[model samples]
Target: MSAETNKALVRRFFEEVLNGRNLEVIDELVATDYQEHDPFPGQREGREGLKDRMTMLIEGLAPTFTIDDLIAEGDRVVIRWTNNATHSGTFLGIPPTGRSCRFAGIDIFRMDDDRLAEHWHVVDQLSMLQQLELLPSS
Candidate 1:
């Protein structure tokens, strides 16, 4: 697939699947053997695992995502993004703080035949935790 096409595929995963609450699209956008290079604590594995993770975040954070930047080359797409959300539901053993939070992250996705085959990401968890008053700010 072309670089633009690869970027589009990854964008859909964020725009549609995560932000839009269209979790079903995961099957369409992700490979069945999908691999998350950095899985969260206690997260499962494979396509189903990815779907489960998305569901958890969407429910927990009720986040609205914005794609800040998208760059693609070969089969890899790198996306810089931010999300603003409310802690309306539990996430990662942290109960809902009813606190609003904003955070940013960068994710790199590897495309295989137009589907996302692998993913790696770095999210500003410290900022989010501190904003929620779950951790002391330095």
Candidate 2:
């Protein structure tokens, strides 16, 4: 697929799957044997693992991401995003605090045969945790 097409696929993942709460679309967008380089602790494996992780964020934090940028080179698409969310449900074993948080993240995804094959992510988790009262603010 072209770089534009690869970017579109990743955009759909953010819009439909994450914001729209449509987990089923993961089957279409991500490879069945997907690899997440920064898997959260206790995260499962493959597509299901990705789905489970998304579920936690969507359901727990009720997040909505604003894509700051999408840059594609070859089969890789990189996304820079900011998320605004509320702690509405248990997340990472912490019960709901009903606090609101904002965080930024960058992710790189590799496409293979038009499916998302692998991913690497970096997020400002410390800020988010502090906002959620899980960590002391500096």
Candidate 3:
């Protein structure tokens, strides 16, 4: 596929699959043997695994987590965004704080055969916890 086509495929993958809360898009956009190098551990393999993860995230952080400044380059897309969410639910051993916080990060994606084959992410994890008052600021 052309680079442009690959870029479009990735866009659809995110919008229809992740943000749209549609797991069927995975079958359309991702290959059967899709692999993801997630920074967070315990995420299962294959598209079903990804769907489960997304469901957990959305349910846990309703109306809070969002993706912005999303852009694509060739087969790779760079996304810069902020997550402004209230700590009303458990996350990474942190209890609810009832405080909303904002943390920003960037992620780079590489597609394989027009499917989301791999991902590398860098997020402000420490900053997020600090903002949520779950950790002391460094």
Candidate 4:
């Protein structure tokens, strides 16, 4: 796929899968042998692992996730995103605080045959923990 096509696929992932809470699209957009370099706690490897992580996220925080920026080169696409949500369900052993939280992250995706094959992310976990009152504020 072309660079533009790769970027579009990533955009669709954030829009349809993440923001829309539509797990069904995963099979269509992700490669069967998908891998996550920054796997969530307890998450396994492969496309199923990605689904598990997404399910946890959708259940824990009712977020309005947005992509702030996107860039594509070769078979890779990078996305800068923000998520605003209320802690409505347990997450990684942290019970819901009923608090509003906002966090930012950047994710890089590698495309294989026009499908997402690998992912890596750098997220503001400390800021999110602070917002959830799980850690001391700086």
RMSD of each: 0.8, 0.8, 2.9, 1.0
lDDT of each: 0.91, 0.95, 0.67, 0.90
Question: Between 1 and 4, whose lDDT is larger?
Answer: 1
Cα deviation at 112, candidate 4, in Å, is: 0.3
Tens-digit lDDT track of model 1 for 22-74: 98999899999999998867778999999878978988899999999999999
Per-residue lDDT of candidate 3, residues 1-138 (tens digit) = 666676577667656755676777777776665566663355677766666666655544432435676677667777766767666665544556777778877867777776776667787878877887778987
lDDT of 4 by residue, 42-69 (tens): 9878989999899888888877788899
What range of 10 consecutive residues in model 4 has the weakest lDDT sum? 56-65
True lDDT of residue 61, candidate 2: 95
> Which is the leading candidate under lDDT?
2
Candidate 3, residue 77: Cα displacement in angstroms equals 1.8
- Candidate 2: tens digits of C-alpha lDDT, residues 1-138: 999999999999999998999999999999999999988777899999999899888879999999999999999999999999999998888899999999999999999999999999999999999998899998
Question: Which one wins by lDDT: 1 or 3?
Answer: 1
